[model samples]
Target: MSSSTVSRNSLEADQQWLLRSSSPENDLDRDERPSKPRRHIVAVLCLVLMFTVAGYVTSSVLLNNRLEHPFRIPKLPHEEPCDFAPSRPSWNSMPRHRRHAFISAVQRLASKPSRLGLSNTSMYDDFVYVHTKVVWQVHHHAISLPFHRYFVHIFEQALQNDGGYDGLMPYWDWTQDSSDPLASIVWDPWAGFGSAGNGCISDGVFARVGKFANYTENGYEPHCVTRNCLAHADAVDESDGVMHSKHWTPAIVKAIIDDSTTYRDFRQRLEEGPHKHLHAYGIGGDMASASSPNGQFIPQPKHTLSRIP
Candidate 1:
C-alpha cells in the first residue's frame, strides 16, 4: 500500500456512499409525489353539485308557473273516432224555426206540465223526484232550482234529439256571494237551475245561502219563499222589484208560466227583447237566459206552461 493508492481508494469509497444515500432519498421523494388524478376527481364533484343546483332551480320555476295558470290537462285518446267531435256550431248556426223549437222545448221542461194556479191539470207534477237529498232538503216545499251539470247534460241531449241545439244553452253562474256582498254585476242574470221543473226558489238565493228564515232564527230554519227572492225569480219586468200576491196574480202567473208553445214564445221574445240596461248607470251587455238544471226545455205540442190551474 502506497500512499497515492490509499488516497484513490478512499475517494472512490466516499463517492459510492454518496450515490447510495442520494438514490434512496430520490426514490422516496418520487414515491410520495401527488397525482393529477385526484384533482380531476375533485373537479367532477364540483360539476355534479352545480348541475344539481341548476336542476332544483329549474323545477322551482316550473312549479311556480303551474300554480299561476290553469293546469292544462292532457287529452286522452278518444274511444271512438267521433267521440271528440265538436258539437254543432254556437247559437248563430241554428235555424230560426229550429231555434224556436229548441226554445219551446226548454220552456216546457222548465215549467211543470200542469198545475192549479197557472192552468188546470189533473196531474200533480213531482219536481223533487230527480233531486238529490241535499237539493231536496234545501227546496222541499220551495221551487227547485235546476242543477248546473244536470241542466247542461239535458239541454245537450234535447238539442241532439232535435237534430242539434239551435241555440247554445245559456249559462248563468250566480256571481254573488257573502264574501262579495256588494258585487252584483248581474251578468245577464235572468237565471240558471236543480231538481224541479222550475228551480228551487225559496227566498231565491239557492241552497248555498241556506234559508232566509235561518237569518232571524239561530238554527237551521225550514225553507220558505220570501218576497226578497232574487230579482230573476221575482219578475222579468225589472221594474217590479218582486211583486207578491199570496197567490201570484193570475196575469203575472200566466206571464211566468213556461209550457211548450208559451215557452217557445217566451224565449223567442226574451232573446228578441231589447236587453234593457239592468242597471241604470252602466251600459248593459246582452241579456242571456240560463238553462234549468236536470230538467231540459223539450218541445211538446200538448205541454202547458204551468202546473197551476
Candidate 2:
C-alpha cells in the first residue's frame, strides 16, 4: 500500500465518525427529554385559565337573572281592584244634608271616649292630644304635608266607621272667602259654620254641646268649644306684622304647584305659607292653639287629596 492510499483511508474513517456523532437518535436523546416540573406548570396554567373563564361565564349568567327578576315579592291571589274614588267636595259645593251628616258624625266622634290612654276624656280630645304631641316634629319638617294628610284620612275613617258618615270630607276653599272671612257664607248660622261668639261657640253644629273634652291651657280638661273671631289689629300685627287676611289664592297655589320641584319644597311652602295663614285667620280660637279645640265649623279639609292615596 502506498502513503497516499493510507491517507485517503484515514479521511474516510474521520467522515464516518462525524456522521455517527450528528445522528437523529443522538439529537432526540438530548432535546426531547421530558421535564416533570415544566409539564406540571403548563398543566396548572391550562386548568387555571379554564376555571377563570368558567367562573366569569357563571357570574354573568347569575347577574343577568338577578337584573331580570330583581323583586321576588309574590302577588296576592284574591286581590280585588279598587274602582271607586271618593269625591272631596268644597264646603260651599257640598249639599246641605251632607253637611249636616258630616257635622253629626263629627259630633258623634267628639262625644265618644278617647281610645288613647292619655288624659284625653273624649275621642275629640284624642285627636287634640295626638296633634299636640307630634306638632313639633310634623309641623316644619319634610313630612308635614304627608302627616297632616294622613291625619285627615284617619279622621275621615273614624267618621265613616264610627259615625256612619258616607259623605266625603268637605274642604273649606278659603280662597273664595279670603277677602271677607267674617262675612263668608261658611259662617252662616243656618247652612254653614256659625259665626264666632264671645268665648264659647254659641252657634253652629258645634254649639249646644254640653262640653268639649281635652281643652285647657295647661292640661286635658273638659270645656266648651270656644272662639274669639273678632280680629284685633295689634294682636294681628304682633303675630304676623300684617292685618291683611292672607289665604290661598289660585295664583299663589298655581305658583307653588308649578315651582316646587321636590316633596320637601312643596311641603314646606304649603305648611308654612297657606296652611298657617288659614289657621291664623279662619277659626282663630282653638284652631290657633297648640292643643287646639276639637270642634269647629268644619275641619278645614284639604282641597287636593294627593298625599292620602
Candidate 3:
C-alpha cells in the first residue's frame, strides 16, 4: 500500500473513533441534565409536604387546647358573699335604688336580642322559650325545685354579666303582705312590680314597657308584663261559724315549714298550698296558663344558699 493512502485511512479511522466517543458523551450529558431537574423537583415536593404536615399538626393542637379549656371570666375577690351578710333579701326589704337597678337590668335584658338565635326577638323571649320547652320535664317532678333554682341563678348571672346589674336578685315574700296582696308594698305603682290591670300591666316600673316577646297564647308578639289579683273566700270551721276571705298568709308558710320533715314533703305541701294560690292570683293571660309564667314560683328552702339544697 502507498504511505499516503495508509495515513489517510488511519486518519479516517481516528475520526470515526472520535465521533463515536463524542456521541456517547452527548447522550450522557442529556441524561444527566434531566436527572438533576427531577431530583430538584422531588426535593421541593418533599419540603412542601413537610410544611403542610407541620401546619396541620400545629392547628390541631391549638384547636384541641381551645376545646379543652374554654374561655371564661374569672370571678373577682368582691364577688364572694360575706359570711355575716345576707345573700338575698325580700323584695320589700331591698333598697330602693337596688330595686330600680334590678328593674332597669330586666328592661335592658328585654331590649337586647336573644343570644340563642335571631329567630328569638329578645333575651326575655329566650327565657320564656326555655321555660315553655322544659315545662313538662321540670314541673311536677323531683327535679322541679332544683331546675327552677338553677334557672333563677342563670337569670341573675345574665342580669349581672349582660345587663350590668350590681345588686343580687331579690325574691317576693308573698306571706309578708298576704293580708292584702293587691295593696302590698311590692305592688306600688311608682316603685314596685306594678299593679294588675285589665289584661296587661298598666302601672309602675313595668307598666306599658312592651318588651316580653313570646307567650303560649300569643307567639312572637310585643306585649307588656301582666298581672291579675283574684280574691277567694274560705269557709271557716263550723264552730267558728264565719267565712272570711283568705290569702297566702305567713301562718300558712309557718305551718308548711313546721310540718315538712323531708324535702319531698316540703315540696308537696308548698306546691299544693301557697305556691298554687299565688300563681292563681298573681298573674293573668299566659302567665296563668298551665305553663306558668314564673316557673311555678318554686320557693327556696329556708336558710339555704340555693333553693334546691
- Taking all chains together, the TM-score of candidate 2 against the true structure is 0.65
lDDT of each: 0.26, 0.53, 0.49
In model 3, the Cα lDDT at residue 4 comes to 48
Q: TM-score per candidate, in order?
A: 0.23, 0.65, 0.62
Clashing pairs in 3: none
User: Quick one: best TM-score, which candidate?
Assistant: 2
How would you encode candidate 1's per-residue C-alpha lDDT over 110-196 as one tens digit per residue? 333322122221111112111222221211111112122322344354434332435544321111121221232221112221111
**RMSD, one per candidate, in order:** 39.1, 38.3, 35.8
- Tell me the deviation in Å of residue 91 in model 3: 1.1
Report residue 168 deviation for candidate 1 (angstroms).
3.7
Write the number of the candidate with greater TM-score, choosing between 1 and 2: 2
Q: Write the per-residue lDDT of candidate 2 for residues 1-309, one digit (tens) a residue.
A: 764454344333333433443345422223222244533443333222222311222434443434221122113233588687666777877778888888888778776776554444766566666665544444454434554665566667677766778976677776666556567667777678676533566676556666754655356667766554544222344333322255456666767788989766776577556665555443445555555535443556343423223
Best candidate (score: lDDT): 2
Ranking by TM-score: 2, 3, 1
Location of the lowest summed lDDT over 10 successive residues in candidate 1: 280-289
For 1-309, candidate 3 gives per-residue lDDT tens digits of: 764454344334333433432344322332322344433443332222222311222434443433221111112225466778436767767778877887788778777886566465766556665565545344443445655665566666667776788877677766666555456666577667665433455677565656554555335555555444421112123331111114346676677778789776776566555554454433333444433443222222211213323
Candidate 3 wrong stretches, greater than 4 Å: 1-86, 118-120, 217-219, 230-247, 294-309
